[model samples]
Structure formats: C-alpha cells, structure tokens
Target: MTIDLINDMIPPLKITDDATKALIWMEELRLHALPVIKDKKFLGFLTEEMIMDHNTVDAKAGDFLLKGENCFVFEYQHTYEAVKKATDFDFECVVILNDDNEYLGVVVLSDALSIFSQSASIQSEGGVIVLSLNQSDYSLSEISRLIESNEAQVMGSSLNIDKNEPTKFRLTLKINKIDLTHVIATLERFGYKVVAKYQEVKSISNEKERLDMLMRYLDA
Candidate 1:
C-alpha cells in the first residue's frame, strides 16, 4: 500500500524562534532536532546539541548555523525515500516540501521506521529464507520458477550486496508456506546456496499452547 506522506508530518519551527524554545519543543516531542522554516520555505534543521555547544539558547534559530538544509524529500516521494534520506544524512528526521518548494513538515526517523515495520511485506505471514549467490548467477525469474516448482510462491524478496565480497549478493526471500524444506531443496538443486532460514513453527506452537490454556480455563 502507498504511504500518505502528509500524515507523517511533524510540525516545524520558525527560523526566528529562540534556541531555548527549540530545545523545549525537542524535549516535549522527544526529538533530537527540528526543521526551521521561513515564509513557508525550509531553511534547515536546528539541533539541541548544536545550540548547547554554541551556548546559543537565547539566540534565534536563524542566527545559528543549521544543518541538513538539503536533506529533504518531496511530499510525493515514497516513505522509503524519506528513510533513506535520514539514514544517508545521519539526520534525526527528513524535511518535506511541496511541488511549489513550500515547506510541508518533517518525517522523524522513528516514525518512518514504524511505518516500515508495519508495511505489508514486513507484516506478511511467511517463512524467510536467505541465500548467498554470485551476482552473475542471480536471476529473479529463475528463482521464482524454482520456488513455484516446489508448490510455494515467493511472497516478497530483498537483496543486499555482500559486505565481504562485492561480487556476491545476499538474497532474502519471504515464502508463503511455513514449511520450506521442499523450497530449499529446489533452490539448492538449481545451484543456489541457502544461507539461513526462519520458519513459523515455534510461533505456531506457542499459539496452540495459548489456545489450549484458554480452553482449560473456560472448562474450569
């Protein structure tokens, strides 16, 4: 599902606002930094540590040097883009703007993470399998076909470059079935190396135990 960027908007601060007020707002909102705007234009971000380091509590936000002025995303951008921007800039939040270049608000890293965790792919009920493969040998269509041959479908998948080997990649797949024995066999038969696997059997067992306890309590 598409994310509504505007709904994640965190209120911004005016450039003329005092650093002390900014600090108070940060404390109240549990934010490390906040965006500074002027005439609906985003100037930059002001951090509590920056103010404390400069001893500029009484100074206006505009009077101090702000950071991450260019660290922003358009309102139409995806939520992942905001997360990426925040991670790339090492910023506490990501600024948002409209098509007209007007300041909208900021998306806090914490909120972005929450949205990401609740995303469909993440919340889907499935078993996860991680595979290590050479870049040249990687073909998504081939992998899907192998999975389908085992009567299992890939629910979702992600890839990351192997840190130790630039020519290799780590592929993570979410499979619809909790039992992945057949899927793993099929992939390995096709020369795919299975690195790790996670199943829902433990969770299912726990749930069954809880249901049994509930039934016993009802009978008592």
Candidate 2:
C-alpha cells in the first residue's frame, strides 16, 4: 500500500510568507522540514536546518531563499520511492504533484517510513491464505480454532471486505510448518474456507514497486 496522508498538508510558501511563523509551525508540527509548493507544483522543501542556519533575526525563509536540497515529487509517485528519497536526502517531506506537476499533496518522511516499516513487517512475518467460503457460511472463530488446534497462529487478518456477490477473507497466518498440514485438513473438513496459499509468499512486487516509488519520490 502507498503512504498517502491528508493531515500531512503544510501551507505552501509558508517559509517565504512568514519565516518566523514558519519556524513556529515547525515547532508546533515537530517537523524537521515542510514542503513548499506553488501553482500545484512541488517547488521545494523548507528545512529546519536552513531556518536555524540563517537565524531568525538576520533571515526569514525568503531571505535565505534556499529550499531543502531542492527536493520534491508528484502524486503518482510510489510510496517506496518516496521513502528512498526521504531516506537518501534525509528530507522531512516529499511534496506530491500531478501529471502537469500540479501540487496534489505531500508525503511526510515519517509517514512513508511508517508505511514501509509496516509493509516490511507484514511481508516478513505474514502469510496470506485464500479461503473459499459461501457468504452464508462465514465464521472467524471456527477458522481461528482450527488454526490453533493445529498449533498455528493468526497474527493479523484482513478480509476483502469487498461486498461482491461472493465475499472472501484473506487471512494472514503466522504458523509453524508442523501444524500447517493439519490446519489445512481441519479447515477443509469443517467447511471452512481454504482457497490459495500464499505461504511465505513475499510480496516481492510490492517491495520492488515500493523501492522504485521511494526512488521517484526523491528524484522527482
């Protein structure tokens, strides 16, 4: 999943408009840097280091007129790409844009990191189990019991929750291989769902795409 956040918005050109106030914004938001955009285009980022380097008495954001490493990005930019850029430059924000380079939003490095870390964790420890069950025949506890009965464990779960004609829940299981066979058998016998097994299936594509995404987030 991409790391997109609405609350990450910081006013465009806040540094130029009021350097002193922008400093205050940094304090309030506890952000090391913020995106500076204009006309929906990601222009650059205003950083805390720059602010402090100039000093409040002698310079404002516009006075120094230097943005954070001249970094920026577009909306379609992938989340992992954003993370890599943020990581490389140590930037605080990755401003997002559109096809015409119109500013759509911003991605906080922390937010992107949060997303990447979560994705990494899930991919490393989670297993996807595709279960085939009728809409009228859905039971979470029974599945849990079967898993536990086989000495397996479900770490976290997410259902398609897509209310299509036939609903499906893709469960994430963290289990020992010893119990996997029994768990599968019990599930099949109990009329519980068992469709496909993404066991130890790393979302490699997600990783690749995300990595590229972070790259773009930085380079763009």
Provide the TM-score for each candidate, comma-separated: 0.63, 0.50
Backbone steric clashes in candidate 1, count = 0
Off by over 4 Å in 2: 1-3, 6-9, 57-60, 120-220
Among these predicted structures, which one has the highest lDDT? 1
Residue-level lDDT tens digits of model 1 in 134-217: 999989999999998888888767676765677898887878888889999988987999977876443322333433322221
TM-score of 2: 0.50
Tens digits of lDDT, candidate 2, 35-137:
6654555556777787777767445455555564435555565665555556667766666666676666667766665465465434454444556566566
Best by TM-score: 1
Please state every model's RMSD to the true fold in angstroms: 9.4, 11.3
How far is 191's C-alpha from truth in model 1 (Å)?
Answer: 9.9
